[model samples]
Target chain A: MQINLALAQIATKLGDVQSNLEKHLDLIEQAKARKADLLVFPELSLTGYVLQDLVATVAHKPTEDDPVFKHLLKASHDLDLVVGFVDEDSRHRFYIASAYLSGGRTLHVHHKVYLPTYGLFDEGRFFAWGDSVRSFDTRFGRVGMLICEDFWHASPPYLLWLDGADIMLFSSASPGRGLNDKEKLESARWVERVTKAYASMFTSFVAHSNRVGYEDGLLFWGGAVAYDPNGELIAQGPYFEEALTVASLDLNQLRRTRARLPLLRDERTNLVQKELDRILSK
Target chain B: MKIDLSINTNLARTILTAFIKSEITRADYSRAVINLSGGLDSALSLALTVEALGAENVLALRLPYRTSSPDSLEHAQLLVDQFKVRSETIDITPMVDPLFERDPQMSKTRKGNLMARARMIVLYDQSEVFKGLAVGTSNKTEILLGYSTQWGDSASAINPIGDLYKTQVRQLSQALGVPQPIIDKAPSADLWEGQTDEGELGFTYAEVDQLLYLLVDERYSPQECVEAGFDAKFVDVVVKRVRRSQFKRMQPPIAKLSNRTVGYDFLYLRDWGT
Candidate 1:
């Protein structure tokens, strides 16, 4: 089976949910017109990033009664959607999360596990850390989702791979930073390298989308991209601009790539679990 | 222990241009006002503002005091002519000399600060009338060294070149086609006739920039910088300057008497709702 993926690299207004939702709906219509099977938006698509005090104001539950997700869920009845937002639990704790919606229902929600506190990020002070990393069944295949800093660490994607996720969706509102003689933003170069490495190592299709435009002084570089299971670049969007790039993924390539290089086949999870248990017990 | 400060000029130019455009547009303003000092930093900043918000949109004001170098005005004109930006030459001597005359025994530093603040007053006034943002021209080296006046030349709505070091600023000014003389000339506060930045600071920009790159960007300790082959005395001076000037780089702290003070817990981005 083949799946068409749309990378919605968009700029979000700071602390504005209504405007961002309207933009999402407009993009969903365009993605549907392009016949995309799944449209993935950058992290905090509904509520913009850098929400220091406004995180509580914009946080919403991914329920049918929620103002933002209701429209998104209705839109997803026609096409699968992965949208990032501030998720508030019943206890009123907010977490940076992404939800996968299909067939007018929410399939899964992944809270961003790593809240970067150092340097320009203040996520640790604003939101709760998530402790879950699991994959869920989609109409096409088992899919896993992770927000910006979650994919930077190897464990989240590794857990998803072990949970039989054939497709990994990553989204970020990553700022354009670190300029050197390499003629590319260091952040952009580093992200592409890591995503491609994940696709080849895990033998899973990877699609990553980043937002564009500026908030305060930070500029988000938009360069949505995808890699096949063979670690080949399948599609790329423009940098420093808003775009909705579509790529056709031939899921059969996963079988071919795994057959050629059987790293996943020769794994020893039991030995790894025993080693971790010993290290922790000590 | 050698540091490579070389950057991709093309990438820097593209990013800085986008920064000016996005920041100005975010504030719902389509124009920018720059006090072009006829120096390398302001020349480069004007070029970027022109590129970002067209030549006609940027208003370049050449604010000169009575003793300001004639070459400064000419150098500033070169950029105004090169970029075809709208310009106004305002003599700040009238506004600033009253204070200088009030205190005949005033120090050169005091005079320089007064002049800087005077220019800022005009720039901001024009910002309201022209409905543009005041773009800053301070570089990282000066900012880190506390070589700038607090709330004077350092004041700005948004700064595109604040992160670049002085060495990086020269590199970018060349790439952006700022006149060669401006980039090569000795930097000065021009408070006195022969006031060169290096002469006052007692070290060359190239020498301090390397140490600063290690200290600030690479997060090297003063001891580590000495280990990395920098002079201990020079490291002490730079580190102390950076430490002493900490108050200049940050907003004034608010007293935390309530649950959510403005700067402490009531955290919000500058572009909070816009």
Candidate 2:
């Protein structure tokens, strides 16, 4: 099977859901016109990142009654959509989350497992940490979603790969920092290298959507990218600008790459779990 | 242990210009007001602001005290002409003299602070009429070393170059094509006769910038910096200055008495809904 994927690298207005929703709707139409099967937006595409106190103000449930998700769900009837937003739970605790909407219904909602609170990030202070990292089924295939910092760790992607996720969709509102590198922002260079590594190691297609724009002093470098199961660069968007980059992913590459590598088929889960249990118990 | 303070000028230029443009326009202001000191920091900032907002939208002000160096005004004019930015030469002598006159025996340090605050006052007044944001010119070196007066040159609606060290500022200034004279000359607050930043700080910017890079950016300890070939005394002084000036880099700590105090619990980005 082949899938047309759209990376919506957008600049979101901080704490303004209405304006950002309009941007999402416009991008959805553009991606649909380009014959995209799935459109992925950067993390916090609805509620902008760097919202400390405004997290609650912009938080929403994925239910159709919610104002922002309502329009996004309606748009998903045309094509599948992956969007980032602040998710509010029953106790009113918020989590940085991404939802997959297909055929006007929420298919899977992944609350970001990693809340980066260290230097230049304050997500942990405002939002509750997520406790899950599970991939779900779609019409196209079984896929997984991870927010920015979640993919930085090895375990989340490893868990998804073990759970049979053939397509890893990643999103971020990563700020541009460190000008030491000549070719790209240090953050951008690191993210690209890691995503490609995940694609190659897991033998699964990886698509990363990063936002572009400035919020307060943070500048999000929007260089969205995709790698096929063979770990070859398939698509990339421009940096520091809003863009909708579409790439054709040959899902058959998964079978081809796995047949050659056979790394995923080699079973070691029980041994790995035994050691982890022993080490963690200590 | 060697630290590379060099930055990719192209990357820096793209991000910094975008920062100035976005931060200013997001606040509903297309214009920016900068205090042109004829020094490298202000020159680089003005050049960048022009690139971000346009030569027409930037209002460069030459706020000179009577005691300020003549080269200060002349160098400032070079940038004003080079960028063709809108400019005004407002002599802050009259505004600051009243305060200086009240205390004839005031120290030069006190006078410099008064002059800085007075220039900010004029800069802010011009920003109101010109309807632009006041762009700050303080670099990371001076800010970390506590070399600037509080509420003076440090005041701005947004600062694009606050993260760049002095040496890095020169590197960026050269890349941005700021006049050679501005980059070559000794940096100064120009508060009094023959005052220089390095002379007062007791070290060159190049030396301190490297030490600061390790101590701050690389997260090296003072002992680590000393072990990294810096003089022990130099490391101590830089570390002490950075620690002492912590107050200058933060908003005043609010005493928490309620469920959510402004600075304590009510943390929101400055760009929230603006």
lDDT of 2 by residue, A155-267 (tens): 99999999989999999999988778478878898999999999998999999999999998899999999999888999999999999999999989988898999989895
Task: Tell me the tens digit of each residue's lDDT in model 2 across B93-140.
Answer: 889899888988999999999889998999999999999999999999
User: Model 1 — TM-score against the truth?
Assistant: 0.99
The C-alpha local distance difference test score for the whole of candidate 2 amounts to 0.93
- Grade the docking of candidate 2: medium
Per-model fnat list = 0.88, 0.79
Estimate, for each residue in A1-282, the C-alpha lDDT of model 1 and write its tens digit.
Answer: 888999999989999999999999999999999999999999999989999989999998888998788999999999999999999898989999999999999999999999999898999999999999999999989999999899999999999999999999999999888887786899999999999999999989999999998888898999999999999999999998889999999999998998999979987889989999999999
- Considering every candidate listed, which one attains the maximal DockQ? 1
DockQ of 2: 0.77
